[model samples]
Target: MLAAAPTNALPRWKGFNVLDFFNPDPKHRRQHTTQEHFRWMADWGFDFVRVPMAYPYYVRFDRSRPIMPHEVYQIDEQQVQHVVDLVEHANRCGLHVCLNLHRAPGFCINAGFEEPYNLWKDPEAMEAFVFHWAYWSKLFRAKTRDQISFDLLNEPCLREDMNDQFSQRSAVPKERYRSLIVKGCETIRASDPGHLVIADGNNIGNEVIDNILDLDVGQSCRGYAPGLVSHYKAPWVFEHPEHLPEVTWPSVENGQVHDKAWLREQFAPWIALVEQGGGVHCGECGAWKETPHHVALAWMDDMFSVLTEHDIGFSLWEFDGTFGILNSERKDVAYEDWYGQKLDRKMLDLLTKFV
Candidate 1:
């Protein structure tokens, strides 16, 4: 019989996402991650790493003009082994890994990339989704919950259609998204019931906390509170101005004051889920590189203040790029060259202090 799960079976997941793993460039993908990266994270006082990997990398796709679901898409065992090796590496370094599907079979937040069918509405897509998770369960069957956990999907939201326009307030009903989650969780449990599964909140992991409470799974909330501040001037952000003026920490925007109180209120739904014993995590949150250093830190302080108060852990959007503490090229902040990479000392200290 399986031992009872501890009350705190969920770790306070403070860490980073190896962004390089998400639809990486073919030529340099191999150079993106190494055992040293996990060691670096562990040494930096982080105990976890949430890997947002793309599913397309593991499945074979047809080169035909329009990709069809019926076309043979095989899971490459070799790719599976590569992920397994990464998990083992993370374990050796004393950091638990959260394996996530950033780009699943039939849906994704990205444009230009085609997933053909809708993940929530299409039967074929749902089948492929379950197949992916079931295979992962079998692959990591020997792994215990403490060593690794499953983040079934990444930033799932209500999509307008298969073409990638989505929003927090999606036309797709919450019940439909919840049902799809139930199916995915069931598939994972069928293969490996011992492992805990985490379902990303709807709307880029920002909303719909109550919807997944019935499932035997944890919930992940996005930390990009007040998107204007966190994603300032980011090209990908909707309606991003070609040139944005510097934004203040508590400045008023969109007719609402931006402050700590507001930040806390935004987390109300996730807090409610946590109160109901529905283990909640701040899965992804960070400011863009172009944002001024002082402004970003102040905004992050308020965000972390609320997270710390709630005893919730978070994984910063990344580890070594635009949003990461190390190698983050914020022009306004002075950085130290640590091991040939730019390290923002103050930023790193602030993140660690919160933990």
Candidate 2:
């Protein structure tokens, strides 16, 4: 039999990412997640919720153009309170919250808006990045480590030359990533020493951060490896996804091999990090809604099995979007009527099985 995956310091907290403010622009913001959603997640046996927020969502910045360095700290009290309230409600529902900066001062994995600075190379951007973390660290200082954690950034990488959503992602220089993380941790610890900080794996959560072994912060990994299986026809990720090969699990397809062994190999580095005394968790996981439902479930079963055997837990990309359970808009699913909204019971049931 294969060796069981190594154990780590982080909790095996399974959950989902609720994208209420994933986009910085007000136009893209979805309906804010309700208290009932958290209650349902807890009721369904999940224990974690990752709120991926755009920094500008709660800051006063000139939305029509690139943000100026001087405008980074203009905190909007109402917007900040909205996030604060969401945290409290989730905590009350007995959920652990890991708030993430999806769009930071000078960086974002997705493109469209003009960013006046570069997160990996510019000093000004770094300052604003830390400033927001510091501000959030202080604002939520009263919470215990188990109640709240901060995800430093979402999918850290260098896509400087790329344009539009189809651009290829390159890993941020490991040294630059290390530098920002070290300082990010230092700033947070300065105010709340016990608060947990998680850094996403480099290369858009594909590779582990081998350099920051000394830091106490946990590292987050992605579940969408073999994009053919996870993002199959995701328009944002593919320019011509329709031309892709047929997708299958434990078989070859999607321009790459796919199987439980391949999945395990992809996460082998993270499991090794656990052996080296680092805490690891999959901060995001799940195939897009368009992939055949049966295939998505099968892939997730193996993915969750790999993660579970290793004592690692994960958060699905969303609770109510293309990659989620509610109103996912999956053409293949027979959705259940859930409070006037459609629900993917099979997907929900599959998730509960792992929990």
Candidate 3:
């Protein structure tokens, strides 16, 4: 009815998240994603890249000091230019880039840093968050949507009134969270209206809320459902994998089966938004290398099949390392050399099948 969300101006085919490749540490970040990496993606029938960047890496602020309530942040001109340069390079390599903020001034999913105030509740923190987007919009306002787009925030998990993790049983009202997101989107849109804006759903992008409908932006969803199937034995998600029971694809977990029907139900929320003229993307989706390759493929096949059938665009969790398609350190995957790095032919074959 709403023109099918404008055909997702960006590529709809498979892509990867460049998480560690853009580390805050300059030397380390520079080393991970290389020209070969970009070339490999293009050659392998993939052309999209989502770069999850930490704000501190591009700003000139004291990492050790706590954020002041009214602290005015400053963007490093050189670092800003570096991002523009990186985007240009990616474009040159025939890839469209989705610039994302994995860590913002007041919020982050990871538990390493402590914010002076909760971003969701603190006006100053929200101001800084908006300012970051505003800065980028002003700098890259001229860029076309095909070359790049801005992902406003990564998994916004902060509760409505408190800067804490979101709990499914007890969480902020969806409208309240949407209002906070609206402010940031307004700030970006007021300056740069051309570049597509993407907002991740709450609860690590797993739950898509209706609040985003009026914002004139794209919505991003998560793919790691039925954690038992996607993240089995992954230490980051499970405190004690040894204590957890075994998992199987399309198997019943807690009475809810991880089957195609269940998967579609999870996606129904965002699909409604997509029908309402909002772009929807599976911003992140991939199984941890610890999962059995065969099982992972089966689950992915079901998940990806539904997403593709619905004409939804998605990017896999990563390009390399634990969850990547290329040379992932999975115990079960046999690897060979492709572009000088270990390549998983089986994984590649499976991934390309969908493409």
Candidate 4:
């Protein structure tokens, strides 16, 4: 069974996204925020920040190699130290940090990347993937268990159209994925026995609870909860015109309850898995620009309630940009725009309950 944190240990919770750290300026490379970001998060009543990192960023990605890139698997010590420094900074600011492998050496489930992992066929790629985790485990062995955690992959989807080794046809049976997860867990535990390992759900946070329960990987499992409520208005997502009078939280009408109950229902299986020795962290969940201001607030209110009720840790999708809490453009919409209006002190106050 997974052990629980002690009572005095920073509540094992609360925080938002730390997106800029990994996706930093190409020139700046790994250089990210110091005290300011942590202090700001602390001030906002957040106790943690999920830092999504790409493996290729730390290692050189050479396009001139053979099958896979030649330098694709090597980890640079200097780059690794930069990440270590960020963790230490986070600790100093009293923030829990989750080192997320957002983009692995060969794959990103996000579709924006050119090559995604197809572990079933590529032996070299699989070795690199496992080796990367092993390397990280060795590097971060010194940090306090609760002070940091590791998210295995951002989203390992089992989609049919991706045409990768992990697709429906050539996919490692669900049992094999469990074994890989165990191997990854064992690798980390061998070095840093106490650090938490968060395993992403399959189908991009849509499935895997069933697999997790059935396979029985010996650790607490967690996953990204997604931003369906907030993404109803995202341009990338197509909504049928026939399905108009779009359904949203806070309701399109006044009295009806927006689909909060259904959203919670979707989490039922994962909640059950958590009940059975696994822990849950809703790694990604947020409202996007498409959601109306009042509706977004209402959605957050409901979402927060459910998360708190279930005692799940969550991180908003981002800090700045489209679905961001802080808009990068610094527009004065916080008080004016409907969406902006919902993102003020009042919303922060509500979020404080969990943080």
Candidate 5:
């Protein structure tokens, strides 16, 4: 059984990240996560939905050129309303909604479009980033914490190429990262004082944030550690995705022993946060389809077991794409047809066991 957090800890929310509007390119934006997806999740004993958004996907901007700093303030009600609609639908289906800026005003984890300014170095970008939180907070002011929350940003890090694995990547100096998070939380409360806010862990969600606990905000972690197991053959993440060695569990490879013990070791920092009055959740986690099915499942089991033992909840990276349980397109699994989509039953069963 999963243990409970301290009295002040955030609710242990278990669900998947819904990619309703995640793409940066307006033309290639994914279809809105269906209403049936929400209902299915509720019926399957899940109670959380994370909507990761690309700012460009919901704003009015020139498609022919990159968005300017001033353009960040251009509010497109028609496009933005889609988020409101999905949040309400998910809430009605008994799921708490966490809205995240996967691709924010001036920074993105992936190499989608060129940002006009650096979020960490430019004052203009920082203000624009906070403005977004303020806008979203006021838009849903009437909704309580039980129905809504805001994840300030997606995995954050400082890298030369941002997307390339070979780039010079480093933590966003903790002092700077802390200030940004504090400002974001403050901005949201200025509009909706009773709202709940969560900040992804620094350094691409791999580590814990000890600085923000006193602010009454939860901290989110990731499950994509030992990238060989989670992101194998992922083009954007690995320089040579095609040459990634075959994954294995209970085996020492890449100078790292990837077994249950290593899984627990990775989670130690987040566990310390809980002891100090903070809540932890795995914000984005899953292996790409190219990974051998059985190896991926084994890694997921150990990771989930450690999270459960530590009293943490998680949101899978996505609901219906390459990393999802539905239509994952992995050749090895014997899929179960669930309402026309190929469902990975083993993955679902594993998730259910931990939940």
Candidate 6:
């Protein structure tokens, strides 16, 4: 029999989303203050930041030929330089970074993509996807594995049916997704040994963990804590309410039924899978401004409690913006001014359990 793998204590992780880093506009790109952001996060006691990158933003997508600026797939020297500078800056400010591929070369799980790269049916698209990961693995060769990690893909839609919005039932099964994850892991490992890779569940939603646990990926899984609180308010998510009911606060119980208990149910299977597969991390979770200050705080309190209890490492959904700890409209809501009400001190305190 194999001896048990050592259980590593989950790090007390906190940070924001580094969105639009590669957008052409200087205003949007400048918003990603490599040094300033890290300094602020450190000041707030956060140790990590999730940098979401759109592949096309870095690599111009073309249907006729291989995407270019391809020093490594579509990514070029300029993009790599920016990332390296940010990583170095983060180190200077005492922050860890998780590089998330929000949009892959030919595919974006999010509905907004004009042409979603359906890997299940398109052979060329799938190859491009693999090539993209291979390129990233090669580019980040200098950084120490733990100093930076890769979130394979953000919120992989499992729906196969083109008609079914959530249907992942295409020619590719969940097993193929798992295989692709392992393949990506292998590629990364080959390029730079010991680099940590985070594999997100089927969908980056609370309900997908149970479904993921049943699939065999032959490696540790990362728990994706969907922004129910934030997204619950997002116009696109269908059930968002501008003001949550009073009952939604104190207890996880609510008329919706998908409360704390539902969260627990989602986690249990993942936890078991973690034990069996080795370990896991909560890759993403947060609430939006739609949730009133008090309700968001309450929901966060519950979220931290459960995650800490399970010894799960986590990176909050974002540092700033709709689901951000600090609203992106910092000029208007200034971090200094909104820190008291918007920061959720009580919830941050609960997160100390993980620390």
Per-model TM-score on C-alpha atoms: 0.91, 0.96, 0.88, 0.78, 0.95, 0.76
In candidate 6, what are the lDDT values of residues 1-355, reduced to their tens digit?
A: 9976435333446555676463422234645555876886687677877776766555534635444433225445565677678878987787877777776654555554444446656666667767877777787777775577777776665554433344443223566676667677777777887677766666443323333334332222333333454455466554434554432454444344555666666677656655554346666666655655566666666666666666665776565556565553322232444423355444455555455
Model 5: residues with Cα > 4 Å off, grouped in runs: 1-8, 162-166
Candidate 1's error at 57, in angstroms? 1.2
User: Model 4, range 52-72, lDDT digits (tens) per residue?
Assistant: 886765765553432245566
How many clashes does the backbone of model 4 have?
1
What are the per-residue Cα lDDT tens digits for candidate 3 across 1-355?
5544335423474688886424654445633566677887888788788989877677666655754544437667776677776677778888888989888777777654456676767787788888888887777787778878788778877544333333232334687678767877788777867767888887678776666666677778889887887788987677778898876787987676679889898888777666666678888998888888888888888898878877787788888877877768888877888757888787777777777
lDDT of each: 0.77, 0.88, 0.75, 0.62, 0.85, 0.58
Q: State how far residue 316 of model 4 sits from its true place (Å).
A: 0.9
- lDDT for 333 (candidate 6): 32
How would the candidate models be sorted by lDDT, starting from the highest?
A: 2, 5, 1, 3, 4, 6
lDDT of 2 by residue, 1-355 (tens): 9976557989999999998878886667785888898999999999999999988888787786777778878988888898998999899999999999998988888887667778887898999999999999999999998899999999988884534676667988888899999999999988889989999999888889999888898999999977888998888888888887787776675355678988999889988888887999999999998788999999999999999888889999889988999989899999999888799999998889889
Instruction: List runs of model 1 lying over 4 Å from the truth.
Output: 1-9, 24-31, 62-66, 70-72, 164-171
Better of 1 and 2 by lDDT: 2
- Where does candidate 1 have its weakest 10-residue lDDT segment? 24-33
User: TM-score of model 4 relative to the true fold?
Assistant: 0.78
Ranking 3 against 5 by lDDT, winner: 5
